[model samples]
Target: MTTRNIVHLDADRVYWTTEVTYDRFPARQLWALAAPIHELVIPARLRHAAGASRPGDLQHQLVTTFQRRLGNPVLSRLPGQTLLETTGRSSGLPRQTPIGGRRVGQEFWLVSEFGERSQYVRNIQADPRVRLRLHGRWLRGVAHLLPDDDARARLKSLPRLNSTAVQAFGTDLLTIRIDLD
Candidate 1:
């Protein structure tokens, strides 16, 4: 039997651990490990080998919800380690300008790439109050990062940005935690 470890982490540095046996590991395991790390809750139904498909995956949905929203949510770390701000395009449209809002939970995850140093990062360092729009949905939320040492350490380990954009712009890629208010 395959045993999977389930760890739960709360805002106060509290963590719970449990083990689950399964004939075969499911893809959900990847997100399961990260859910707690990111303060997200995974439904029990998804824990099983055959996880149910999310609602937005179906076509003809009029309005997109947080779960359906797409794109790389923009993030910024506040000064004094107080908070981390996330922002992105709300409508998931390429030309549609981003609007101010909180990033829908589970909509996006941190990528290996370090975004180019631009207004987004500069504004984050200057002020903790930041906004983000989703790539293909109309939703947002303003959040402050919870104080967690482990989370901060994880963010620090991300590979530095060395893309052509960074070289051309002469910008440095910085890593910071995501704090929701």
Candidate 2:
């Protein structure tokens, strides 16, 4: 039950080493078990505070920073992961984001955790035309924001891991339907 503290270049990357009662203990495996518990047990008051359209507080910054700096890079490289490429509203540059969604026939569907406040969602508003990467291929598509769609119900129909994340961290849920070419 000894704890070891690891400090990286940044505070966000800090890792604490801890011994668990599980057999064949490994740091990665321990983390794999602890991460979900940590997220799920977040206080309701904190979740509510962090789940605003644009939260300027520390919690929101911490979550977004870790995801952008670490999570996105890892998820984007995974096989069969869906990616959404949107045109930046002001910069007019291609902004590629790794997303979770399902492809059914000629349409792809997903929900945004941050609703219109998400960067990708805002980009889609600027220009409905977008591109999607799925099954190792890039394809053109048009994005449609479905405000009327029930986000919680939509999560039930999406991949479990992503749906769980959306439910845990999302402040405002937004549904997006992409018509593929």
Candidate 3:
């Protein structure tokens, strides 16, 4: 058995590969049956993850819980999903949170569904320096929590489907602007 992780630095892609060899006939037979099931189950769990799909339809506590558990991890790994990476306030570690946003000029804009109460929000407050994975490329930036910015109006400027989801499920909407360097 062998595994390979191919990282294309230029393309910013990670390819997960595994090769399994069964020596015995029974082992091969068992694996043949399991392989098909494996194919179906893996992608299914990934899809079940709110991050892989979208959790916009879910409500407050549910949204937060589901997203924290099932959203960010899968979403952050998606090919083109945007990820916000911040320094953990107390732990002093990098924390990546999947977010919905759009880039305008050199700035990346997003609305926080949880406002200042979100963990990432508090992280931003502690330290504004951050990284954003946009369309597969990592960009260094500084995060700004815009309290006065009209979040609803800001949503209108973002992607329609995501903005609609944010409008539908958001309780405390706050605008966040990341000035990219």
The lDDT of model 3 is 0.81
My TM-score estimates for the predictions, one after another, are 0.23, 0.68, 0.67
Off by over 4 Å in 1: 1-117, 138-171
Per residue, candidate 1 scores C-alpha lDDT tens digits across 35-115 of 443332333223322354443222112111221243222221222111223333343222221222222354222211122
Give the runs in model 3 whose Cα sits over 4 Å from its true position: 1-59
Residues 36-132 of candidate 2: C-alpha lDDT, one tens digit per residue: 5454343333445446333533345455657787888998888787889999999999998999988889999999988887889999999999999
Top of the candidates by TM-score: 2
Please, what is the whole-model Cα lDDT of each candidate in the order they appear?
0.32, 0.79, 0.81
RMSD of each: 18.6, 8.1, 13.9
- lDDT: which candidate is best? 3
Candidate 3 residue lDDT tens string, 29-145: 787666655555544444555255434323455677667766777887798898999999999999999889999999999999878878999999999999999988999999999
| 10 residues in a row with least lDDT, candidate 2 | 11-20
